[model samples]
Target chain A: MRAQFVLSEIWIGLRRNLTMTIAVIVTVAISLALFGSGLLINRQVDQMRGFWEGRIQVTIYLCNEVSANPQCQENGPPTEEQRAQIQTDLEAMPQVESVTYESAEEAWQHFSERFESNPALVDAADPEDLPESFRVALHNPQDFNQVASAFEGAPGVDNVYDERQILNRFFDLLSGLQNAAFIVALVQIVAAALLIGNTIRLSAYSRRRETGIMRLVGASNFYIQLPFLLEGAIAGLIGGIVGSIFIVAAKFLLLDGMQDYFQFATTLPISELIYVILLSIVLGVLLCSLASFISLRRYLRV
Target chain B: MVGSDTRHHNLREHAPVINFDNVTKRYPTQKRPALEDVSIQVEKGEFLFLVGPSGSGKSTFLRLVLKEERPNDGRIHVAGKDLARLSNWKVPHLRRRIGCVFQDFRLLPNKDVFENVAFALEVIGKPRRFIRKVVPEVVELVGLEGKADRMPDELSGGEQQRVAIARAFVNRPMILLADEPTGNIDPATSIGIMKVLDRINRTGTTVVMATHDAAIVDSMRKRVVELEEGKVVRDQSRGVYGQAY
Candidate 1:
């Protein structure tokens, strides 16, 4: 009987304030969707960082016949003695975890394999154009400068390049995007909360007569406030369900497109997206419930 | 008549169902206290009339009994429980034993007669079967029998007041507080409403009615407690709304 009464009350309240309810639902949906997107973006950045952590390296290209650098061109190709000395020096450095020499032929093969997804790009490159280099794995990716500075103008060196620098720039851009999403989501959530609070206030005002009678006849605070709380909760749940659709759409349209464009960047799987969706829904429900609870506080004081 | 069969009769004969001792209530916005150092005792099964002008603390007295407002000083005891010591959570339990009727009739406009009366039971978590059985009987008792399906707006002013009375009496509270229940209805209708309240009073329930209707008070000849400016000025048994006023 109580459940029926509460349900009926919720239905009545929702129907009575249809426009406000719809406004609350739409606001909550947009807010939770942005929230979920923020979570997904954060996850994507983490995944990319994890995938690249082990593979990042600093490459030192030797002075070869076809090199464009003034140091390499003037010196021509490094002698065998110069190559052995550079290799020994890199191996002795504390920051260098490991060093491996790649021949021009091997470099060509790796480049071809890396760009195999785009056969046209791989076919445009020649084996003779590739340079022989030492790929240095560092103890700490942040310590790339230590290795780069050591061999920058050393004999046989054409140019020293650290993959961390390029990867950091890319990760910085993703982090900025993630922060923007969070800030926007925060604003949306505040708007949603205010809307929820107003909806509850309007609902409470419309039902003041019932609540006054309820109080007179000995209805507990919970008993009197249950229907309003349920109204907010139902609005939140509906918003969450709608937001999940947005989240799924974002996964398919936004994240998937990103994955396709940046093939090496790892994006979230469906399972993780499902988790984020559930979390967003729960957050939406909590936000609305809290807002309504706050708005109904003065009335409950009786 | 709802809990007549199972109602407890263990209280001593001298014990009052409602007791207020030197209770003073002041609103922060108002200069004078609403009820200043006023006190009264109402025994079980008594029909009492609280008569006074508009701002004589009649409503405030009823609110204090229901623990709806806390007294600024002194204490109130209802049904042998000290209201000042009662926690906020226990206020509802205290209210369950005291039914309140208002001048406005305070009926939910959207609900029908039957639903309004049943609302009292439903809010307290009464079973559907029990509500079904008791709501009709109380509706009939208040003389709203066949009009159970009519909404509050559809009913006459008198009938609306009857529905409000039926809702108050449905819980079979030990103390019924009526704040000008007849204020909005005609004198003839007010008499009928009084009869219903008198009947409920005879059923071993204490009825405290605050009213401005002199004719009804003079005719009923019940206990009359008259207030003036937040202080009790007259206490008369079988009073006639007092000729001095």
Candidate 2:
């Protein structure tokens, strides 16, 4: 029954201050939208990260001259026995998945395919002079250092390169951008909370006389605080709804509609969109609830 | 209807509901005290009137008695709780023992008469079933049963005063403090409000009414305490308005 009274008072208060309520909703919506967008950017960065890691492989170049080094050297190409031993060692290792050995002729053919449009460059180069290379695959991409560690001083190897390091710098840049957005989102959320608090205070002031009369009529301070708290909560709920709308719109317009405009792409799962929307609602509820609590502390003191 | 007590009633041993001992109230912004060394007693079932002009601090006296403001100079006891020593949290409990009405009627303009009357009980965590049973009874007592669903604006001035009285008395407070309950109404309506106060006092509730109505005070011959410039000018057993007549 007491619950019914609180609910009834909240209902009347919401109906009474319709315009201010809408304003609060708009402020909360903008803040939560910024927060949700920040989260989405972070998730997108994570997805692109996994895609880049899967393709990062170590490239093993063979010697061009008849050097004694078994892996690679600038002076000479590897002997057939040395080449067979390297292939056997790579295949037998647990970390190694598969290694495709491209001979000098094959390497030249691969280069020709890349520059196929320019027939002049293809005819000018000698296929027999090109060095043989090993495109190495690994079971664990993060253990790329392990592959480099194993072949550091190998006999016939000229160089060992991992593509993953190049991709990491890009991830770092994206992470920095996401962090900035998060900080701004946090600031806006604090602003929204203060907005809610100020509005409640105004509401209290508008009816200051009535509050004094209620206090005179034996109404408890806790009882007086109930209506204002409910008013803040309802404002937050409306704000949450508006914020979720922005999140859904961003998902459709940016992620799907403009997919081809950007070079990198991702498939944002439906579950993730729903999670962001729910997160916006939770943030709205929590922020407004805190604002109402702080505002009531001073107002109810009198 | 005064109580059916032609027999000699012992007033002293009836347990005074409102007691003040040298209570003085000074506002923070004021250079002079609003109430000065005022000590008074009104027993349960006593009908008393506190009469004073504008600056005599009649409302401040009522506010002090209800624990709305603590006295700066001396001890004030209301319903057996000392105003100075009472915990801040228990202020509401102390207030519940006293009912108060205001000069402005101070009704929540949004709520209808029924909810307005129910508000007094609702704040104390009273059960809804009990509120339902009790609110209508007090509404009928104040002759506002027909206007239960009407908001404060929809009612006449006298009717609003009746609703305010109903709200004050619905909780069954032993001590009732009315601060010029009839100041805004006509003379005929003032008589009607006085009748309501008289009816409540006849039921063993101590009532203290602050007013400047000369005819009503002189005719009733009730106990009157008149104040001048924050000092009690006269405290009489059957006092009239301002000692003019």
Candidate 3:
């Protein structure tokens, strides 16, 4: 019977402050949705970093007939003896994890296969014009500059290239996007919290007469404040469910939408999205409950 | 002080349900204390009137009994428990034994007569079956039978005050405090309200009413405690409203 009374009171309070309740719910929903999106973006960037960082290598390209570097023009192409000496020197270095030599013909073969979808690009390239390179995997990818400077002016070496430079630019852009999402989500969460507080305050003020009567009739403080607390919880739960739908939509539109253009970078799977959804829902409920508790403390001491 | 212990023991045998000892209450914003060094005792089952003009400290006395305001200088005891020593958690239990009626007839505007009365029981976590049994009986007791469904705005001022009285009395509290229960109604209607309170008092509940209605006080001829400037000026059994009587 007491539960019934409390439930009825909650219903009455929500109905009385329908507009404010809706505003709180919408704010919570938008905030949680944005928050979930931020988490997804963060995970995506981390996944890309892991995928790229593992394969990062420093390559040493030998001078060929079509080489454009000034060093390559002066030295022409390296002899078999110079190439063999260069390979043995690279293998002797402690930072070198392993070295694999690729001939000009093998480089052309790999390039054609990589761009097989673009036959015009394959037909435009010639095998002899491609440069033979020694690919060196490092024990620590950050030691690239040490190896690059050692091999920069070496015999038959055209140039030493670190693969991470291009990848760093891409990651930087993605990290910026992730940080922007988090900042906006933070602002929205604050907005949702304030809206929840205001809604609870207005509801308490409108029902001050009833609450006064309740106090006169010997109602405990918890009993008097129960309905208001439940009103906030109910709104939060609804907002969370709404936010979950937006999260799923965001995953589809934002992540999967870019899959065709950036096929090499993997999108987050369903299980991770499910985790975000559950977390967002729990956060929404807790935020709203805390805001309501605080507002009640300030407005209704009873 | 040695003989006082036995005297208090004897007093406990038929203890005054409400006791005040040199109680003084001063609101920070006010120039003078609302109640100053006021001492009074109200026995169980007594119908007492606190008669005074506006700002004479009658309402403050009621509020002190309710523990709504703490006395700055003295002690108050209701039903053998010291109000000063009572913990906040136990306040609701203390309040459950005291019902309050106000001049505005502070009935919830949204609730009808039955719900308004039942609300008193409902808030205290009374069982629904028990509420169903007692609410209607109390409603009829206050002479509100067949009008249980009427809203507060729909009822006359007299009827609304009766609803407030019924709500206060429904929980069967030991003490009923009425702070100008008849202040808002007509003189003819005020009598009916007083009769309802009188009936409730006859059922062994102590009644403390603060009112400015001299005619009703004269007709009732009850114990009247008059206050002037926060000091008790008269305490008479079977007293009339004025000194001329």
Best by DockQ: 3
How far is B225's C-alpha from truth in model 2 (Å)?
3.6
Candidate 1 segments whose C-alpha is farther than 4 A from its true place: A63-79, A92-97, A104-131, A149-158, A265-267, B1-12, B243-245
Clashing pairs in 1: none
Question: Which model is ahead, 1 or 2, in terms of DockQ?
Answer: 1
Lowest-lDDT window of 10 residues in candidate 2 chain A? A66-75
Can you write out model 3's per-residue Cα lDDT over B1-245, one digit (the tens) per residue? 87999898887768789999999899999988989899899999999999989999999999888888889999999988999999887787889999999999999888999999999999999999999999999999999999999999999999999999999999999999999999999999998999999999999999999999999999999999999989999999999889854
C-alpha RMSD values across all candidates: 4.3, 6.0, 3.4
lDDT of 2: 0.81
Report the C-alpha lDDT of model 1 over B14-86, residue by residue, as the tens digit.
6788888999999999999999998899999999999999999999999889887889998899999999789
Backbone clashes in model 2? 11
lDDT, each prediction: 0.90, 0.81, 0.91
* lDDT tens readout by residue for model 2, A20-95: 7777888899888777877876787778877766666778777776434554444466678768877888888799
State the TM-score of the second chain for every model.
Answer: 0.94, 0.91, 0.94
Angstrom error at residue B86, model 1? 1.2
TM-score of chain B of 3: 0.94
User: DockQ of each model against the real complex?
Assistant: 0.62, 0.45, 0.65
For model 2, the stretches where C-alpha displacement exceeds 4 angstroms are: A2-5, A47-55, A60-160, A206-213, A252-270, A300-302, B1-15, B84-89, B108-115, B122-133, B144-156, B226-234, B243-245
